[model samples]
Target: MAVVFVITLAMLTAATVISGSPVTLTLERAFPTNHGVELNQLRARDLLRHRRILQSSNGVVDFDVHGTFDPFQVGLYFTKVQLGTPPVEFYVQIDTGSDVLWVSCSSCTGCPQTSGLQIELNFFDSGRSSTSSLISCSDRRCNSGIQSSDATCSSQNNQCSYTFQYGDGSGTSGYYVSDTMHLDTIFEGSVATNSSAPVVFGCSNQQSGDLTKSDRAVDGIFGFGQQEMSVISQLSSQGIAPRVFSHCLRGDSTGGGVLVLGEIVEPNIVYTPLVPSQPHYNLNLQSISVNGQALQIDASVFATSNNNRGTIVDSGTTLAYLAEEAYDPFVNAITATIPQSVRTVVSRGNQCFLITSRLG
Candidate 1:
């Protein structure tokens, strides 16, 4: 289901201490003021597509998501990323749903040149960067980071090509490249220092579906999913940044938010351990509740096993979804508390109560 929830997580590593100072990135709304409801439709469509993939496949890798946030929608958040030796800036959607930082490259077929968010869209050219280098399929980094163990590599010079398909039949195909990525880390109260680090990212040579459109397109996506190919994993592996990161998203769409790398020195913050070895941030869900009323269901429904895909907390999705067996009982119990006179109306494909007046 397309859920619009924002959750922050802290990923800790026992092997090494965090090297760099904390960095802060500003998140800009993908859509400007007066964006319409069509944003929800687009999100729902994408979420529906993603659900099918989840049901069909388990632990999908080598996937690079296209422009994550809708350029014409108000809910999606994005930022500008400066990369390469000459320091070219590219607008990328900051997503917590997936891993791998990728952008459209020069001469990419069907890639949009402009965005509706009033930003100058530019394609990444490895030739322009003096420090840019191709990552071959034979490289250990490619094998460990983006490729599966069963994947084969021919030679050291063989370019590591990747094809990322989205749920909506949209995808981007490209090769891997590494270059310098710049970021500003916050040192102390409003004082920040600039730093640069070498990282691997995708250079898309072709794109299809929604990525080819300008209305919801940007440079590419900066995924924060739990994967080895993610920027967090690469930086942590190189001792440039910590394995931990946190974000505080504003509820208001127009107001921007903060994405911080490393520990957040804030008061009254509580953290829990993350489940190891899962595609997303897999968490053990205890129970479900509505208005302080916990649902009366079998504990096995919330159980996690080797085959059962448990609960995940993602900031990129637009709606919350429940399993079929869990959904029926939850909905019935919720409607049980409501008056029979209250009619039901369908809104955006979801059931809504049509009460004549507010009755809380």
Candidate 2:
């Protein structure tokens, strides 16, 4: 659903505090690395892909997951996930904006078999896995508030199934199943522990919109949300991982970064509090400044209310959506900070411009 990105999730636990434990994952950018394609051309496609991802706020991470940034193709980053007994590997998009991890299942209706990305896509065959079990409505995990909101019980078999509708006519529906997920846990500073945990995830039967298309399709999505059903929470509940996870993009062109299951403490690191009673990782934006000079915009402009939405840290989206009212001042401050002679246009391929829109 379009509001899936805006839906409220569970409260955070103190377990997120920096400690010795974390789960690490390797990631790959969902960009097509075609040497024949023009860089700008790929950049243009990046905007289109980004728009499709958002136009559909929209809808849509992580053990110590790290990813590469594709300069030519800027899109969602994906990671290889191992599920089932024999452990079928699947490439799933990493999303912090939405809850629930799902993959295209065998006998799927509209799941994409192949993807435009360099990697091959794999379907989750629950029927083949000896350890796989359907999650019934009466199951304790199925009765969670978040699961109950989207999941329904089938009278015939008491199966717990769900249908998530998105505003852009894009959505996914499937049944709940419990399976083994293999992970690499990070201990001490860098020690790695190979591990496995039982997690409840979705076995997608159908998909619509951009999801059904192969251009950017993958096995499914891996959600790092703070819900009982999310892999992150389930692992935390099992004492296999911490509830709090942190993500960061590398400063290099590769756009690579870290997605750790536990907090990472650094010297002189700035700390910010999560807004209480708000969905997602909501943050109180006290101010905005360019080169030490504050933008002449009202602090209230960033405030979240019952009607007006505020700021939340969402990793699912590649671009930051700024409010129209706050755009000019923010841009003006940046423009003033930069020398007039500085090149604003980079061969039309790397042109930089602010994106303005309303988010509610």
Candidate 3:
């Protein structure tokens, strides 16, 4: 349900050591999935063996992997959410592609009421604050004029509804709503700051098939990418800079990804040159080269013509999917690298290599 940005790190480093502050946001509540029920019961060793470990090489954070959902070219992670006031936890996916953070609603149809994963934060129940509102169909932010396919948004009781289809055909659908979000900010070693920001999110009331019943243990996602409305946008509005996030995919919970608020941790890490592509808004991509060879693909493969900078460089996807032409060359190169003994031919005429052992 949540969209998370993931980065691989070889080791764990302190965020405060690299930056001035180390903010820790802890979730003490239980999730609605079976993993939530059994998380504490299992010993550390058992948990380590069963869970997909993620860490941040340069942050003071760690978390367990609830489950993995692969849709489209995106891979999503479901994790536990704990807020102090609610005393309950919910499962959420961490996404970096879009902005807005939301969870499943208690009143949502088919949503788990007793799963113990709902966010019970006081901000949600405060009589003083207006209930988080949903975006209307007439609103400009809502994608309109399209039939309710998995890619398009729909109108529900005047609110915009969303359906996200992953590359693997797995997706989630729900109504969008706004809510108050809080992040524990760390400043200069011992200084701590807390800020509340408004976030737009999807509260899926009903889900079916693998989506409704996932091993990931969460019902929603958190988008923190370069999109206009992502959590980073809110942070920028609050005057936080150098906002960067790093997640260690192969480490312990104590070693998690760092969501940098205002600056890059190291200048060298930022050395990767950013190339601009025209006609596409936020989509930024140079040619994709395999090993040392460059592949020819359509420029449209980066992003829609209207949103160029919107090009997403995602690590979650297991395979590098590009426009058909680009995919062809990459596949061809791989097949050429292997001998006939290790290659298998498929009915679609695609050849796959069977690896008997590690290449290294």
Candidate 4:
């Protein structure tokens, strides 16, 4: 459920050493300030996006995430990505909950021309980029994607293509292409240098649902997941950057934060063990405690398995969702802890309840 918590958003997902310099990109809040209706829609869509990823994901990749406690306002984050030899800038959603990086392409059906975020959206033209090459189905990455149910191809063209249908009915489909991903790497933890690497990403040819609308549109989604096709994994596989990345998000009036592809070594940092051998960043949740009181729910309900989905920390999701068993009890405890005097009113298209008082 949606709760007001945290100001600085930080997270680390997996770690490694980079012989070469790791890159840093400009990260900022993607939504406009004071747009209640649009913000609600954005959160609703992100929740559905994570649901689809958690349900369909077959493998797991490791990463670390750390965030300072603050009132996390209504906004999803994005990063600036430069692609092709000429380096066209695109604003892509920063999502750790899913894998693969994709962007709208030329001749895309239903892709929005304008964005409500007021960013100039540019489409990736594979034909225009001399370094761009269409990924074949026979490629190992395509096979890996196929095994994970992330890709497919027909005998006629042999092009590796993929599709995702979100829980909110939004969907995107495109083919894979190999091209240059430009970056500004930090050298020796001190110097900044320009560099580039070959990366495989999506070229969206179609879009549906909210994705086709301009209100919350973006160039594409940059996923930080545990898939072989993920850009972060690709970088880690090489000596360019580690699998881990860090960000400090601000939902304030002046919205900007850090999004860097490097290790975040903070003093006295505590690490939480991720649930072993499961796809998605599943956590071994033992129980839920509200204030000084614990909920009367069994811990087994939070368990993850081949068929049963468990609790996960999704960077893309604006709210936390519990399984059916733990949901009621947890909600009960939260309701009990909070004063009933605080009214919960439906706002922004009935997407969430606006609470007037702080629950401490």
- The global Cα lDDT (0 to 1) of model 1 is 0.69
Of 1 and 4, the candidate ahead on TM-score is 4
Task: Estimate, for each residue in 1-360, the C-alpha lDDT of model 3 and write its tens digit.
Answer: 545342333334333333666665444332334233332444443434422222223222223344333333124444554332322355566655444455665555444433332333211222233545666777544552133121234443676776666544555566665556544443332223344555555666555444454333355666655544455554555554334555434333322243334343443543443345421123356577766777666665664454332355553344455666567776777677676667475757765566787654
**TM-score of the candidate numbered 3?**
0.56
Clashing pairs in 2: 1-165, 1-166, 23-64, 24-64, 25-64, 69-254
Best by lDDT: 4
How do these models rank on lDDT, best leading? 4, 2, 1, 3
Indicate the TM-score of model 4: 0.75
Model with the higher lDDT, candidate 2 or 3: 2
Stretches of candidate 3 above 4 Å error? 1-75, 78-88, 110-179, 191-200, 208-210, 225-228, 240-256, 273-284, 288-291, 295-304, 307-311, 315-318, 343-350
Error of 2 at 148 (Å): 6.3
- Residue 340, model 2: Cα distance from true site in angstroms: 6.6
**TM per candidate:** 0.71, 0.71, 0.56, 0.75
Question: Model 2, stretches more than 4 Å misplaced?
Answer: 1-72, 145-150, 165-169, 189-194, 331-360
List the global CA lDDT of all models.
0.69, 0.70, 0.47, 0.73
Q: Judged by TM-score, which candidate is best? A: 4
* Residue 86 local lDDT, model 2: 86
